[model samples]
Target: MKDLFHKSLSRRSFLRYIAATMATTAVDWFKIEAMASTVEPKSDYPVVVIGAGIGGLVAATYLAKNGFPVTVIEQHDVPGGYVTSFERGEFKFDVAPHYTLGLSPFLEYLGIQEKVELVKPPEFFRVITPEHDLILPQEDPRGIIRVLSEKFPHEEQGIKSFMSLLNGLLQEWVKPFDMKTISSTHPIMWNLSKLNTAQVFDQHFKDPRLKAVLCIFGSGFGLPPSRLPALVFSPGTAASIYVGREYVKPCGQGFSNALMQAIENNRGRVILKTEVESILAKDGTVTGVRTTNGKTYTAKAVISNASAPATFEKMLSPGHVPDSYMAKLRTYRPSHSYFLVWLGLNKELRGKFKGFQNVVIPEHYDPEDDDKATSACNASKTRFQVYIYDALYSGYSKPGKSTVKILMQCGYRPWKHFEADYFAGKKEAYRKEKDRIAQILIERAESKVIPGLKSMIEVMDAATPLTHRRYTKNPEGAVLGYEHSMDNYWIYRNKNRTPIKGLYLASAWGSPGGGVNPVVRGGQSAFTDLMLDWAKIK
Candidate 1:
């Protein structure tokens, strides 16, 4: 799970890499232990955020902007948690190829609109299926309808109805969400909340292939339609697709740097490489946090951007969390992880590539089968997104080369067994397994879209679920955090508030769920809740 080249990059090396990023604008922006009897006295900050993920950074930035003393602590040397980038040779690969929305409004609100660049990707992305190859424009519902209707003329009315419904849902459902007026009682959303994506699709269309195409966007949530909550799928996946802008950073470093800049400019402290040992609390209220390096930080309020399960099970002691809350956390399941292949090619693929973001779904991909196979790491029927950054933007690679990132949803089950003692002969097997899977995935990509893709590779590195766990320490490497299922969509999505007062959750796992935009929104919600609580203080 370490770097592809190094056994363990030294602290100096980490500093060098991170320093380069920081110097350039990589805004280098987790969990718990026991309460200590004696510790040095420390001045209390108004807010202390655990984990420097996008959510944490956003919350910290807001608090600092309002003139509250805030500090963010991260386990990693860099900031941005899932929004990070890693360098290998001349190429820098984004940890996650985030398609962002709400960046403009967020930055504009912070009075830093011009400070960050929200680069729109090439207007279109292609979906390759057995029966059809569809090139859909970004945020264009009619384009999608035209394509689908043309592909399935017999289902023209169905396609039109589906697309129209999605568009209408966008104007009706998503606006309230953006305005923060959405509630569990909202009639339309409440009804939508009860339906799974598959159920909604069934009512609108019958063609299996067409349904698959519609469900592809929901895959961004790391689940197939059948299991995906309609509320999550409709607004963001289906409807929001027409309204939401799609973007890719030349690299996320600059974006992260902008966030950190916003925070520091507001007088917030972003502490790196400082792992939070525990969330300090007394009498059901948060005291602060203690770090691994024997340093204790005192704060009136704390927000955790780490995984939800880890925050409760590992970060807090038994009494600090209530039995009911613990029971709810226990019921939550982490979402699917990913198996990624980062390739630095020897040649530019722009001329040969058709789209900035490409998806390859098997000819007769069944959503149910896709859900099963991918979660089990079966590449045979796996659906994946091929993000050719070089095609989208030029500065990401050397003059003649390009960077290709291949992502497939995979579960941690297959990779977890490899964590046995290395000296006991498990290491080589793990390495070979990673290589084997990477080869299969590469072959899949080559066979489907790019012929001779293996020959073009100059540098290739792969990441398993284990790598994700090792880096972010997310439980089971769930990249998007806890799954957003119908069960949790309305009543159970963990909110910013916890049983322990003044300790709030602010990560992908929190309410509003995953994706960079949602996490940022979650952070804003956490900050809003904190402000409300603060106002209530007599």
Candidate 2:
């Protein structure tokens, strides 16, 4: 890591590298479009997509628009897997995704931009630690540099260098790439990809507090800086600083609804409240899927947006997947889940907090220790992110009221004991445990960020890992799919294509891993690959 940092390239060399990568990306995009235009859709070549998550939805919409018959099957009553929202009395709360990046272009591509309203937070996010309270500016990299430089004057030059590196990484991330050669062609990116975020920070700064400040966003990927891939961390953090973060109006459900509507308008079908019992295959090739009600949907191909474990181990018949594939799958672990508390406050919190949409309060400056506490189920030592809905925009709740959500990274092992009973609908013990944890999180928030938070609550709801698993069907309720460590980086993980022909993956479980933005691109890439495959069938 030190060697790479010591040999930093000149600014001119960096620009030249970026330009080459962008040109390669443009060529790849044109190739995809040319292939897509040449493929003639067959009326009988129907496609079945399992799960109505953003990835599956985007893929189905593109296929349907391109003249192939498409059908989406979802187990939940709603369309969005984890992106849906719920109502509590007069207040509404988003289930997951407080704010998202790269949604505008995606929505516009689906032609539903007008239907969904995205509101930028007053600031990117507010970070609070024992020693400092800082607000990072939105869409202003120079402002961010100024703020951090002022806060940590001694590390100003280091901050500037780090930000410049992140900016370059962000440019690379947004463009297309020839995945086969990206590592070899982009040496800087390749070198940094081998190190964790913490290792990269050590090369630049001497202040632990500054490192902590820069790394708090790692929680968005469900890992601490010590374990998160520096390549993955750079693009996301840079996007937040330069492009800014936006919250969906009403809730994330509105965004999901827009995509669903786009699919329907394009003559696609979205089946809800129906579980896919198994993926039908004959002679080691996917045929279609069978629902829980014994209804069979025959198609030429199938795309599974379900968790990888469920897709390979449970959905398919035993021995259908190759032994080596299953062996590799076993080595990958799911990312951490969350313990969330959604509150419908009787009084508005906008004025009190000065209209801040998001606030992150860590227990201390050490993320590694905080991660350990999370894995150990120690709420006192864990950090939490608070989302104030009313603060983002007005009319989020009834007059004189507001909605807030508190979330913390939580391990699934502690909630395993309640899994059986919770699934069987006997949730007494599960509810008791969840309530206890919720109270601890609420009290921590009240003491650290919101004063008298408990008293203002009109309705309170808490969800455990079991709840997330039950709803999303992600094993252990892993929010970001597989752990995004250097060992399991995107390039090393499974891509959209699978060992079995005609069967594809489009979800957080697939390549270019999680986050609404990456998954959307994953969906598009899956559709592109599927279409290319079909074009060759003649």
Cα lDDT tens digits for candidate 1, 101-126: 54565676677667667676665567
The local lDDT score (0 to 100) that residue 298 gets in candidate 1 is 87
lDDT of model 2 at position 155: 98
> Which ranges of candidate 1 are over 4 A from the true structure?
1-45, 174-187, 238-240, 422-426, 490-492
* Cα RMSDs, all models: 10.7, 4.2
Among these predictions, the greatest TM-score belongs to: 2
- lDDT tens digits by residue: candidate 2, 1-538: 1222112444344344433332223336456556656766556788999999988998888887777789999999998888899887887778976577646655665688999998888887688777778888887777888889999999998988887787666545644566588786665677787888888999899998888888766668878888888888886776666656888887899988988998899889999999999999999889989999999999899998999999999999997999998898888889899888999999977767853644454646787887888887777778787877777877778889988889888999998988888889999888888888899999988887788999999999988888899899899999878888677775676778898889999998887778777777678878877877876875
lDDT (Cα, 0-100) at 455 in candidate 1: 95
For model 2, the superposed segments whose C-alpha errors exceed 4 Å read: 1-34, 171-185, 355-363
- In candidate 1, how many Å is residue 406 off? 0.7
Model 1 earns a TM-score of: 0.88
